[model samples]
Target: MPPVPTDATTSTLANSPAASLATSQGSRLAQRLQDLGPLLGLILLCIAGWVLNPDFATAANVLNVLTRTAFIGIIAVGMTFVIIAGGIDLSVGSMAALIAGAMILLMNAIGTAIESAYLVVTLGIVFALLLGALFGLAHGLLITKGRIEPFIVTLGTLGIFRAYLTYFANGGAITLDNAVSDVYSPVYYGSLLGLPIPIWVFLLTALIGGLVLNRTRYGRYVQAIGSNEQVARYAAVEVDRIKMLTYVVLGICVGIATVLYVPRLGSASPTTGLLWELEAIASVIVGGTALKGGEGRISGTVIGAILLSVISNILNLTSIISVYLNAAVQGIVIIIVAFLQRSRR
Candidate 1:
């Protein structure tokens, strides 16, 4: 090459690193934007709803739509932790139904449909939580000590819990009769400064969940275990304890949600909480949390819940088709979300 002019060579040398740095920074920013696809999808869906139907964008409609998602969102929070820790919990849905049914029956036994019942409701909550913890314990022990797959263990509990709830209902609906109704109605329907009670419940869950997952040593152990159990064990982590603690935490979330959910529908049926575990998983995946573990995105999961509710809300508000097709729409959205996740990975 011919010798360059002094000023030309100086300018070239000064610009080269600047150009390379800009390219590197641009790539990083692009990756961040790409990682935000789910959030973008949620916003796009909301905007689409707004464009298609005026009412879908209203405050009343948004609040009404979101309150119902609180239950699933709460459960999904736990599912986020479980899946990130490299485990799964299928019995959450059935457990919700079972716990809700059991709680109603407990109140009913304490008094029929027409007596004062504060103590009963209090005890009912305590009992339901205990039952949830027990179920979690059973699942954790079986998987950790018995060496069975998490899938099979939770699946077995899923059927068992569903059957137990069905049997408790005796093939009929279990309603919160008048007496209990007065006592428990506010649990779900009550508002705090113009917001639904469950919304606050979910916010608290997110706050606590975030703290536990980010600030604690257990959180690091969990990520390590999920990323590689063998390596975690070799590093002297208490793999079993962390895993069991995670399941117990999941059970606690389910119990808390049940306490809120029962008063909303005011009854329990076999179909209560049907397919909710799938929804929870979908929300977790949509949040960009890794299914295989070692990574987590609680914020993404919350957004995922909002996105799903927004989709169904639009479908309902616009009266797009037969009510039966609602599942079809949700199913399709879930598949799309899943494919997006896999492709990103």
Candidate 2:
């Protein structure tokens, strides 16, 4: 047996180092493709849709899908902060729903019931931002001072906000009254210079986020903290403040998303923004932002959210059976994208 083993070992002398390297190089190429699986999947899907529908590539269709994506895209931008900080915010969907609901409620309660649609909606938007910030503040304090895990804290708030919204509408839809509806329609429907208002908002938000995350010292600290909070603190970083700021940023994003959201439906339901957190997370991960934190991809996240919206819009426009099944398809896409993202590392 030992003699036979010696011959087997001697076989290495028969192999060329060049061939061995070629094999290793082949393996690495395969790994790279695996890493790029999600991006490839997206490209493939786009090609397939283009082939399937002549209208799929039209400016109208593209614009429509992009407009819808802005809501989640904006929220995901804020989510980038929380995730990059090595925390999660499950309450985002509930938070958006709550804000949308409260905004509509406040518009109704506004003094003298202002007839100007934009003014009422403007008031709602401001109110939503402030309220969402309050919620974020609460979340930040609980997580920082109480020393609780962010997942647990956000999960608790997730349930609380969802339940409150349910209680808000008495388990039904909350339609904007006709008077308010007339005033609110233009906020979502109206456009500036032929572009949808939401589109402009998303572009601006992305630009601002890009500047903050990629061009500032605070961004460096965020990545450092996410990479290793212990090391960050030891380096004299303001860990608590950074963490709190992330939450607030996320809250403000949710508020912005809510402003666009309510005008679309002009009402609030417990279902408003349902599962949006999942979309936000998917957008961040798919966009190339790290799940465990440390790095972020703002542009990638923006495109990711658009891809999601496109998938949904195409499904709705096509002759797909059982509209309810659309969600299952979305879940599948998300799982596939997430799997690809994780596999890359």
Candidate 3:
């Protein structure tokens, strides 16, 4: 047998610069793997989809998956900011429903007075965006000024929003006028360069969101707040304002999505945006954003949204599992990702 090493030798080796460098390198490699995990999983999922159903690879089907992903994908981009700043907004779905209903009502009511369908649609779009911003502002104020938890504030607004929409619709659907809808349908159905408008819009939103998150001082402030609010305050980061603005961004995203969605179905009802919160949050988490906040990527969120949409599309195309189980799959995915995040921590 070889001679046993003494404590001095072992301790010297452990304390050496080479050992420290190796440890640091190992940590970086592990972090790199974690960052790429979601993208790799997305690619594997796509391959599995194609293997299960050749149609999954078709251009038409691909566009359809992306088009469907636009709404939640846009919302998930906003959610990336909120989550990175350590905030949550459960009211987005209900808020969308209210905005949709109000927009349709505004367009229809204005159409009766204004002869220009184009003008009516423009006003409605503006109304949707403004309402979204205002709603987001309210959430921010409530959380920051009123000193309430983000979860509790959003949960309360979620119920209030949906209830008001239901009351406005009288427990029925709020259908857009045919004339206004005809002019508006292109927002959802129209294509440019053979790609759906919604998809293009989704890409633009993701691009802007990525820039804001990674490039700006505001982005750094948001991350700092999420990492440690008290520390960030001590650093003069204006934690409350940044946190509030995050909600406003999320609200604006919801509004943009609603504007696109109205033309597709031409109606909003109690069930208009059911379970959207689940999908948005799931997309953010699935994209590799930490549930505890302070860490996330916009690119990861886009990939996560597409990945979830692909899973749903595959389920719809294949009989291996019922499409009804799609939500179940998403829930399970969130749980698995959350567990993985915890393990990493």
Off by over 4 Å in 1: 1-31, 112-116, 320-325, 338-344
The reply for model 3, stretches above 4 Å from the true place, is 1-24, 322-343
The weakest ten consecutive residues by lDDT in model 2 span 1-10
Tens-place lDDT digits, model 1, residues 120-238: 77877888888778888888899899889999999999999999989989988888767777888887999999998988999899788877776666766676677677767777779
Candidate 2's displacement at residue 41, Å, is: 4.0
lDDT of 2 by residue, 1-345 (tens): 122222122223223232233245556676455446567667766776787686888888887887889889999999998898788898899999988888877887772467686677678789999988888888888888888999999999999988888897899977676777777777788899988999999999988987787666676667667767776787777999989888988999999988888889888998888899998998888877778886666777887787788777767667655787888987787777766655334
lDDT (tens digit, per residue) of candidate 3 on 224-292: 677667767777768889999999999999999999999999999999889898889988988888767
Give candidate 2's whole-model lDDT: 0.79
Full candidate order by TM-score, most accurate first: 3, 1, 2
**Candidate 3 Cα lDDT to native:** 0.85
Measured over all alpha carbons after superposition, the RMSD of each candidate to the real structure, in angstroms, is 9.9, 10.9, 8.8
Q: Which of 2 and 3 is ahead in lDDT?
A: 3
CA lDDT for candidate 1: 0.80
